[model samples]
Target: MVTDSQSGQGENNKTNENGSLPISRRGAMSRLVSLFLFIGFWTGIAYIASFYFLPFIQIKPGFIASALALVGILVAASVIFMVRVTPTGGSEARTLDFQTLIIVVFGTASLLAAGGITALSLKPPLLAGAILGILIIYVITLFRIIRFTFRSDREIEKIRSQYQDLIKIERAKTEFMTVTSHQLNTPLAEVRWGLESLLSAEGIEKENRDMISMILKGVNRIVETVADINKALSQKDKTATDYASELKTVQLAELILEIVNVLGGVAREKNVTLSFEGPEQEIFLGGNKDKLTSAIKNVIDNAIRYTPGGRVIISLRKEGASAIIRVQDTGIGILPEDTPLMFKKFFRGKNALLLQPDGSGLGLFTAREIIENAGGKIDFISTPERGTIFFITLPLKKTA
Candidate 1:
């Protein structure tokens, strides 16, 4: 009674026992075809050489025997080398198997072809020397090509594997956060009910009542925090799934101007001058209008919130093949140490926390994710006490 998982593991184990790597049906067929073609190349050259040049030189039985012996030695060495270097299993193994076969076939053919040509051209010492020299160079070139090809292929595979592992880890983290938030909401709701019931009861002394009120406030804050977490996670999941389908042509200039208008009042209250700089002509790009608006608004709002009295500038322009959106703020610039973790979730800089205690630190993280999902990237440069500049680039849509 073997389960499907157990059966799959058993199959993998069986493959490992045979070679360092397992080969797919298609890969095996492709390798066989390559081997035949490689052997045919050398065989064809040898046949042509024999037909055209064999009449010129006298043949000796001893020399022919020596050539045969050389080929046998090469074949044996190739077999041993292939066995020793075979990978434990996959595309690399398939590649190594094919390369080893090529090496053997090429070596054997070169030896036979060179020996025949040299033996026939022996009367012309120059021709024999030249033919041997060319064969030697060809062998060296083949060896160098195989060595570099395998090295690069292995390096690429390692990087690709690491990237995939990182993606899986990120997905797991997101799922855990969503589940934890849901669990916290249940307990948080119960706490809120208990607090409200206590507050509704008859007088329980002035000091005790004050303490309970503070405790209730704390519970309410926890509920809000949990709710925010759930919202962010759900939004991230939604954007990840619906990004491609939600895309439409959006005017870059108008979009930023709308965000600027909405946040202008907030900027004014803080004595921060907000301005929009863009060309009159509309710059169009393909993206989800709602997601793009959210992403752009987040960046602009952060700039306004962070700037104490200085101005926040929102600008858009077409730069070559990309639509560049720049948000520059003259604020308490980010600390050098905090710059690296600026866009990471739940990471508020020390300065940011000190200036604005209510900051959630999720805005930048969510903004970056949305921007990137829309085929754009955000980058920034900051100098403490001077200013910070954020650049968001999206590929421009081509028009007829």
Candidate 2:
């Protein structure tokens, strides 16, 4: 909107960017009165201007009442111009435009006519009464403006209080997730390491070994998930400059395969066919392996949970500077009304709420955040009854 390089000078100099007078009712009444005393300066100038301009009229300050009457008429006309030119609405609506230009021109002319008429009127006492009546009317108008300001202030206070409470709640949620994730990490790692040692041991029986292997896989998945949560939560205080801070090389093909293996059980229970379509060779990139794994896992889990008894396809393809991952699902797709807020925190569609009443509803929200912080984007489209398709794009690392 600010397409031109410009600055204000001369009589219209501004103290702030938007050029509004700084007035508040909180200060002492005396200080407030003194701050707005520029009216005295204008009055003095008006009085002086009268002498040079009114002599030819032959109506001295102490000589006529008709001239005073004319001054009152002009003052009323100026007030009417102000009331009409003042546009409706809040601060933004009050900005000056063509209407403001008209007001400034007509109002200035009316005020000058009033001043000249007052000077020509020789009856100083009559001119004094005319000014008094105009001041009284303006005082009433100022009171109304003050009352509106008070009402606006109360509404602003309510919004501020609500905003502060929301901030506190969010901070608490982040702190709890970060702390709990860290606490769980230690024991989870120990369990994983212990299982790995046992599984690699010599002469283990086949049946017991199979059971241990399954447990180990589950434990390893949990550990990876916990690490991702801790890492994501820990970045709450970080900025865009912290992207890939704890990153390492990750193999996307193997990662998605592992996720498919883990969610395969859930897909079977739900009678949903889930599969992937991509190249056989691995797609390697620089990233935090655990975090990216968790993000993709969230998408797959959601797909399995929502599909009544259908198919979900996750496909990968490389094009230009990026690799695209698409997760297409045959599910109770998002309600049309809820599609816009899909990535909003804890926002579940009506169908989702009905399906999983206890669902935390932070899946896509967390997933999008992780992918974006790792310098990628996640987008999705959904229809009410048919299906949903999510698109994730990550920059492919350049070969040296």
CA RMSD, predictions in order: 13.0, 10.8
- Evaluate residue 139 in candidate 2 and report its C-alpha lDDT on the 0 to 100 scale: 39
Q: Write the per-residue lDDT of candidate 2 for residues 131-174, one digit (tens) a residue.
A: 44444444334333334444545665686567667667977888
Cα lDDT tens digits, model 1, 291-333, are 7887888889888888989999887877688888888999988
What are the lDDT figures for the candidates, one per model?
A: 0.69, 0.65
Residue 43 lDDT, candidate 2, scale 0-100: 51
The CA lDDT at 47 in model 1 is 42
What's model 1's overall lDDT? 0.69
After superposition, candidate 1 runs with Cα above 4 Å error: 1-173, 179-242
